[model samples]
Target: MTSKPLISVIVAVYNGAKTLQHCIDSVSNQTYLNKELIIIDGGSTDGTIEIIKSNQDKITYWESEPDNGIYHAWNKALGHASGDWICFLGSDDYLWKSSVFEEIIPHMIKAESQGTRMVYGQVARVTEDEEICCLDGDSWEYTWRGIIIDGIGSFAHQGMFHHRSIFELYGMFDVSFKIVGDYELLIRVFKEGGNAIFVNGLIVTGMQIGGITSNCVKLVNEMARARRKNRLRVITIPWLISYAWAICFPFLNYIIGERYVRYLVNFGKSSVTYLSYKKNVILEHKNDQ
Candidate 1:
């Protein structure tokens, strides 16, 4: 019998004592056999270290120390990973089910056969109360356009699996990006013609909202910077409008009140969705030819 490929699940956290155990439990309880869990803690003063100590037997590797940012912790964890495939999970994120890895293994094999270095599925974006806001993720073509033209990443990074060769070829995440390092890394790979396969039937992860990625101003700024760093144009109409909206949102919320601002935001989103639908039609036609 052929051995199952090893998968390394890395979690980078800082002062996330409350949700850390749930995250660890989700990974540790995976039905898949060939997997390792690595945790990198950024010197938490909270009870996070104690939780790590408690779960030491289940964890393959763990370290607690001050770090620059999420990407820095992720980069440090990368050095310790010994898996055929790697995935990053947030302390507030958890696998959707115990059987998720078991289910995804076949897709991983398919991706490997096709020379696709990245495989991503959907993630449930949930409120703090665990009510799901929406399912996040899309096809690679849409994701590519979202990252390149819209200054946004349509997929959740938590839902992604990276082949070992991706790191070997493209290097690691850029620590310079505070809010959008994951976006920058994806942009870097896709720009260089790296292939990604989308797993349509699975929702791989459940992520709680209101993380650092929720900071609108920081996220948009870092996204624009990431596009520029990846040698992609950031002055596209969609990006310019997104930047303007991010810059004005706080003031608009304060002046017009958040309720009305949300109404305006929703209207804007509807318009963007229509535009995206139109663009997708064009892309589909091009693909058919």
Candidate 2:
């Protein structure tokens, strides 16, 4: 990527009139110079398409007809994308900041230049009241632990920005699964041994503290599907240990959902402590200098 690489930021929207403007401005106001915004709307009846059309000039490419679901809409957006790397910013959610990609894209290019096949990043949760919280910033060392164990996390159409080749190699979002496509996609990518890199930076912020996914029951169901997909995804699990896990872990979450929440809460709390320690260390180094 010699010249500036164009980042194709795809947005999948469905009746998001309230946050539609926020989502649009978030991408449009991005400090990144070379980029394109593709929005896939699911035939919204609430004037969402009108609002999106009003700013059609700003949209690189878009379609406002009904789609199967979020991942299908995302796939449509991807098909329309014409950039070296593709990232997703959904209608319900927006980027953490206008300059996030500006700061991260160069790092991606550098990583790719280093012969890395792809990179995995992190995401934050935008609570119902609009509180922006980082998944990995607070005591959350193993942010992807849920993904590692139950096969789901804050990743979805968010938390990652990978090269076009990744989708080509692993294939696009699995439309068969509704709520678990993102988890399924990530599991496949990881199992494929894609050049994955972890960045502490905050990526997209999920805006659904009050939504279905924000709730516990729906989330567990989603996880179960994701786990099943993972088992089917990999040719075989490593030895009987993982094979047994692949069979039983999905059901374990139901018994331990409350425990899982407690663990994540503590994990998030601990991340805050670690962040403070690192910040103080940097400041101490500067003061000594």
TM-score of each: 0.89, 0.73
Q: What is the C-alpha lDDT profile of model 1 across 1-289, one tens digit per residue?
A: 1247899999999999999999999998999989999999999999999999999998999999999999999999999999999999989999998999998888889888888888889887776777766677777876776776566555689999999888898899999988888898888777755568888979999998667865677888888889888788887666667777888987886798554554465456445644876887999999999
The per-residue C-alpha lDDT of model 2 at residue 89 equals 64
Off by over 4 Å in 1: 1-3, 248-277, 280-289
Best by TM-score: 1
Worst 10 residues of 1 by lDDT: 265-274
Clashes of each: 0, 8
How does model 1 score by TM-score?
0.89
Model 1 RMSD in angstroms? 3.4
What's model 1's lDDT at 53? 98
lDDT of each: 0.83, 0.64
